[model samples]
Target: MNQAVPAPTVSPLRPTDTRSTAPTRMPWLSLAILAAMGFILVAAETMPAGLLPVIAADLQTSEGVVGQFISVWALGTVVVTIPALALTRGFRRKPLILTAILGLIVANSVTAMSGDVVTALVSRFFAGAFTGVVWGMLAAYGRRISPPARGGLALSIVSIGAPAGFALGTPLGATLGTAFDWRWAFIGLTLLAIIVFALIAFVVSDAPGQAASARLPLRRVFLLPGVAIVLAVILVWMLAHNTIYTYIAPYLRATGTGIGPDLLLLVYGLASIGGIGITAVLIDRVPRGLLHGSVALFVIAGTVLLLAHSSAPAVIAAAAVWGLTFGGASAQLQSALTLAGREHSDVANSFLPVAFNLAIFAAGILGAVLLQSADGLVLPIVMIALGAVAFTLTIVGRRTAFLPRR
Candidate 1:
């Protein structure tokens, strides 16, 4: 096996840290701040799903039209992430991150103040544009600042925000909107962003950006061994995951189980939290095995759903399995790319969110088409097929992508 490439030397921003490139202890305080940033971004992006009815009514629009806010945000991310990362590659990490958080705050604030759908949708676009910058850099940033030996743990800690946002943040935003007003959710997100900005400015350690001479071109980064394969898995896996997720309500309604989409998502989200926890503990020990097991279990879960859609207990059980499989995916994929991209990890990581949002965009269209043309039960069948393909890619990528850590 080829040896892992060494990370590029990062110039420490502080005077006392010049003696060693790596920190002696895990940077919990710094990791937590980054996690907070992730939480805010994910929460801000998905909050609209939970408040769609109210937002639609307030804007005098249909729920379908209001739903486009999420899609537009994703489109903005998909369109901007690669170019934004390339353009800002030379900027210092701390300031760049702070700027992204500030953009989110402003965007969310504007969204909250907007009385018209056009204005709200425009704000969502900017929110997603800024989010592209954030997610593109965040995992790499987490890795850059942590103890060298515990990189996986740092990633897991930072990544908790995503699942937590999906599980806790979105639901809480819904509750707040239901109890008060939909605008309040955006207002609340703005407040949280403010606090995160302050924390990141004060608490997080700064890492220097890639030197111009050391930076890899975007094309080179994409072609790097394992980078493309990892991204392929992400695209396929997430496309399957999001298709069912986006249309989960209609899918559940078709199962004849009388389960509410809200309850099902709650079940999935809580289970996702557990999955990430397990990934953190086992990632370093069995990275390849963990990835294989997660995807394999996902296929099994899909099979159960396909066969037993009418059984409420079986449906809920499968959802939990699905969540568990998906929860650790971000960390696993990012870690693989970090390894694959090596010195060019940050540039490579930029593609991560692009692949994700593309899947999201495609899922929206695909789910709609499927619902129009076929039965909702076909959704699980798609999941099974895609899950199998994702697993196959992982196996085929063993040499390049999921190589055993040195």
Candidate 2:
């Protein structure tokens, strides 16, 4: 019993154009700017992880306390994203985006100058609150500004920033911390945010917000046919990923493989980039097929990790496979949600960060419990179990949620 929803009304990016305002050309430059925004947000959120020792020493806190920076930020996003989006549904998209980026610049700058852990943690929480706005809008913005047919490609292009952030951003923070001071890492993120701010303001096309009559209630968006299913998949799949990923160093240490976590993450990150490329090429054509294949490959990769814990080469190979499985996940899931929610995509999209952050928080708890009570090998076993659930959900949603383009 799905109600008919109008195709998104593409308002003119500029104020001068008065006729039908849909863009005839692809906004690649704008898409890149949005991608850069994603890049800085993720890098800023994760950079602290790479600078734990230096940050803790400078703030005169323990490394264990500094580690909570990531968790606190995730909690902030979970707390604010949905409510923020619900309240601001009618604001112009570009201003909301710019304001969020500015918030990041301020948050990072504050973190760079803070002398104590309390001040720094407050800044990180605000940074995550801003992230809630930016991430919630990125996919919907990509779709609204692109040709309807090219939405998937635009999403893939924009989403490249996330995996790229994980691959390059964290390492960049580490490099800056090592070369200069840990404060330089936050300063570096602030600099990147400033550059992204200018690019978005001048180059990115602006889109109008939904009219009051057209806006859907947040609860209505939540109950939309495919929205809940997609959110469920994000939760389970990411729970599985973070469970293993958060404890990757411990797990690798147990494996007797001499391979370090940094090297393993690098391999995975590069493979994730490759995965994004593959999705860009094929997502528009075969989303269901591509998703199915990647998830299946992911399950196989988990199996490999389970069986070859002692072989460095096998573990490395499995990391590559896992990276590929994850690289395009943001694009794929966001696209599915958009298709299902149609005109209500913005509210629906906001659920993504909520589900994602909750998964990270849950994974931390789940992984900690297992590590304390059982063997490290149990982490992968949990991954395999959750991945199987994700695979089944995708199968169930094939007709309703992951439907191929006509």
State which candidate has the highest TM-score. 1
The 0-to-1 C-alpha lDDT of every candidate, in the order given, reads 0.82, 0.79
The clash numbers for all candidates, in the given order, read: 0, 0
Model 2: residue 261 alpha-carbon error in angstroms: 2.4
TM-score of each: 0.86, 0.85
Q: Any runs in candidate 2 off by more than 4 Å, and if so which? A: 1-20, 48-67, 113-116, 146-153, 174-182, 372-377, 404-406
lDDT of 2 by residue, 188-298 (tens): 788878988998889988876656777778888889888999999899998888777766655777888987656776787788888888877888799898888888888
Show the colliding residue pairs in model 2: none
lDDT of 1 at 261: 63
User: Tell me, what's the RMSD of every candidate?
Assistant: 7.2, 6.9
Model 1 spans with C-alpha error above 4 angstroms? 1-25, 51-64, 144-153, 178-180, 374-376, 404-406
Backbone clashes in candidate 2 total 0
